[model samples]
Target: MSLGEAFRTAVYKEPVMVWSLMIYGVGISYAAFVKPSMIEPHSKDLPSAPPSLKEVMAGIQAKLNNK
Candidate 1:
């Protein structure tokens, strides 16, 4: 079944599943909006130029393999 159908089944057929999903959703929403992430505010902390192709390729590979 699709994600939507699975979610609907969880909500309608399983009250515990719905509560668990709601808790998970609230946690995710809180993290996305309420959390303060680390980021450099100064330009000096960043690179002066764009990254090289090697860095780009490595990043892509790492992301695809969940490294």
Candidate 2:
């Protein structure tokens, strides 16, 4: 059979396996070659670290006073 016919038969016989392999291949290629940026805690766009213990107490007290 010709190349197209061979490919059609393969797909017809195991469509699920073929599609799963195709998805896995694309995922692996993306992870290996895309080089996605790493997120840094110190990035300017992110808010600073967690509030201090003192700051938390101050906020609680302010909320109580407001009520």
Candidate 3:
């Protein structure tokens, strides 16, 4: 069979494989073409660390007192 016929048969037999390959291709294309700046965060400021357990308990206690 010709290349096109073989490809069609493979697609019919393994649809999931074909779909995975298509998705991988799209992802690769996007990464290759898109600028790094577009993908990365624009802000230079880093996120603050999570609140400590003590801080969390204090907030919970404050809420209980308010209620």
Candidate 4:
């Protein structure tokens, strides 16, 4: 049988299956259509950029000196 038929059969056999399916569908729909800005704070600070080459070199030098 197809996936739809199997899902219908499961739902019919167990009423609780409907609740789980409804939650799953709602979660998927929200994630699919909702904007990220709407879900989270737009004013939140962005992440810092990665270390520069000079910073990385200094870190390596410090490690070598410590060793």
Candidate 5:
């Protein structure tokens, strides 16, 4: 069988595999290209350090108190 026909048959028989491969390809493409471009403009906006446990707990406590 021609390669095209073989590929079509394989895809038809294993649709889930084909779909998963397509999703994986898209994810890799996004990570390699789209994600970097998206993140670059916002890099400065990101916090340099994570919040401390005390800060997080205080925020949570404030929220609870407000409710």
Candidate 6:
């Protein structure tokens, strides 16, 4: 069988394949229609040391998050 015939036969044989293909197609189409902007880089937006930890941390050194 030709490549096109093989693909058509496989797609018809597997019901899950058909449903999966439809779901994937719809997801790609929705993302294409609602393209979103990218986020800013982490390093670029990193905050500097707070000038006055008094108001923010009650005049104490900020503890590390240790994530």
RMSD of each: 14.1, 5.8, 6.0, 6.8, 6.1, 8.5
lDDT head-to-head 4 vs 5, winner: 5
Between candidates 1 and 5, which one is better according to lDDT?
Answer: 5
Error of 4 at 15 (Å): 1.1
Query: What TM-score do all the candidates reach, one by one?
Result: 0.40, 0.45, 0.45, 0.41, 0.52, 0.43
lDDT of candidate 3 over 1-67, digit per residue (tens) = 9999999887998898899999999998888877566656754465567789999999999999999
- Point to the candidate with the largest TM-score: 5
Q: On TM-score, who's better, 1 or 6?
A: 6
Residue lDDT tens for model 1, 1-67: 9999997888889999888978999999877866645333565687899999999999999999994
Clashing pairs in 3: none
Alpha-carbon deviation at 10 in model 4, angstroms: 2.9
Kindly list the per-residue Cα lDDT of model 6 for residues 1-67, writing each as its tens digit: 9999978887988788889989999889867764432334454676676466466674343454432
C-alpha local distance difference test of each model? 0.84, 0.83, 0.86, 0.83, 0.95, 0.70
Off by over 4 Å in 6: 35-67
TM-score between model 5 and native? 0.52
Local distance difference test, candidate 6: 0.70
Q: Clash pairs of candidate 6? A: 54-59
Instruction: Please identify model 2 stretches exceeding 4 Å from their true place.
Output: 1-13, 26-45
lDDT of 2 by residue, 1-67 (tens): 9999988888998798899989999999877766454444337677668889999999999999999
